[model samples]
Target: MKSGVHRKLLNYFLGEDKTMKKFTLSLAFLLLCLSYLPLWAGDYRAAYEKNDFKTAFALAKPLADKGDPEAQHMLSGLYKVGWGVIKDYQLARKWMTKAASQGHKEAQSSLG
Candidate 1:
């Protein structure tokens, strides 16, 4: 009888531990998906169209850094015109070159 009781208790605890592990894994997966939501949802063009250069810069910078040609072009324009950031022709040229190299037609034309 004592052995049976001990075995039941051990099984209950083991089940609880398994449940906790599943819950922990689910929570981690949720957080991971949420963290990437901004990158997936950022609308830099809408921000720029609204004359919100600061927001546009914030949205575009990460994508530009990740080698997105359109984002690089937008960042280059912002740097060239001193819109959201200080006007830095050097940085503008750097980003424009990156975009042009990626075959961004507007950036290529502007560079030419």
Candidate 2:
């Protein structure tokens, strides 16, 4: 009886330890992925600067939808110029307004 109880306790503790290790690894991986977000944003800007509007739109659309002001501003420009999407002043104004509301200076100036 004593040996059985001890074995059960050991197994329980080992299971918990494995769970903790998994959690720690998962957290680390998540942080690593998040750390690359800025690099992706930089890629978007570089694509735009290089006149790779399609790539820039592909990159910025997601971030803009997630409410990144800079991405929203870039998306607005893309919309306004029909660079990567159909020219739609309505959509351009919509994204520009979103960026301006988030205190993007260029967006604000453009709105003015």
Candidate 3:
């Protein structure tokens, strides 16, 4: 089968030995995820600014679980403030450390 320019471009960029369909799917998924990040963070920020801890927690938890530093920092703050979840210094410290390890400045300051 002839690979299209999209496949060629994906191969060039990714440098991986993936099938055409696999490469296309992976690229699409990556693009979708990247596009959603700003909206997802905006939603989280709106929830946080409104003091809707439950909503903020709901929005941040998945991204945090996925190792997003900002989400981890938000999760840490939520734990620290007993918002949407019980205040747990240990959990806060744990998440803060994770974010700090990812070079999040606020997390670094919090850890310090």
Candidate 4:
């Protein structure tokens, strides 16, 4: 009877150990994703305000490529108005269309 109880206790401890390992692994993965997600720029706003549209354009392009509607809209505006970039209406229309197709209201307004 004592040996049977010891076996049950051992199984319970083993189960808890497995559960703890799983929990730790899941937490680590979550941390990794949160730290790395949407890795873009350090200070896009500062770059824009400093008239460093070149850097703003650089930082926003990757986010725009990833389908971020706000980034797409800004990139479209940059292309449309020649804001630190050569005016290119075709590129502007392309990005505006992309944002509008995603249901971005501002992008639709800009396209019109």
Best by TM-score: 2
Overall lDDT per candidate, in order of appearance: 0.92, 0.91, 0.88, 0.82
TM-score of 2: 0.73
> What's the distance in Å from true for residue 100, model 1?
0.5
Pull out the clashing pairs in model 3.
Answer: none
lDDT by residue for model 1 (2-108), tens:
99878766866678556667777899999999999876646898899999999999999999999999999999999999998999999999999999999999999
Q: Is candidate 1 or candidate 3 better by lDDT?
A: 1
Q: Over all chains combined, what TM-score does candidate 1 have?
A: 0.66
Total residue pair clashes for candidate 1: 0
Flag regions of model 4 displaced more than 4 Å: 1-33, 36-42
Mind giving the per-residue lDDT tens digits that candidate 3 earns over 22-91?
7778999999999987886668878999999999999999889999999999999999989999999999
List candidate 2 segments past 4 Å from native: 1-29
Model 1 lDDT-worst window of ten: 11-20
TM-score of 3: 0.67
How well does each candidate superpose onto the true structure, as a TM-score? 0.66, 0.73, 0.67, 0.62
Off by over 4 Å in 1: 1-42
Displacement of the residue 63 alpha carbon in candidate 4, Å: 1.0
Tens digit of per-residue lDDT, candidate 2, span 75-107: 999999999888999999999999999999999
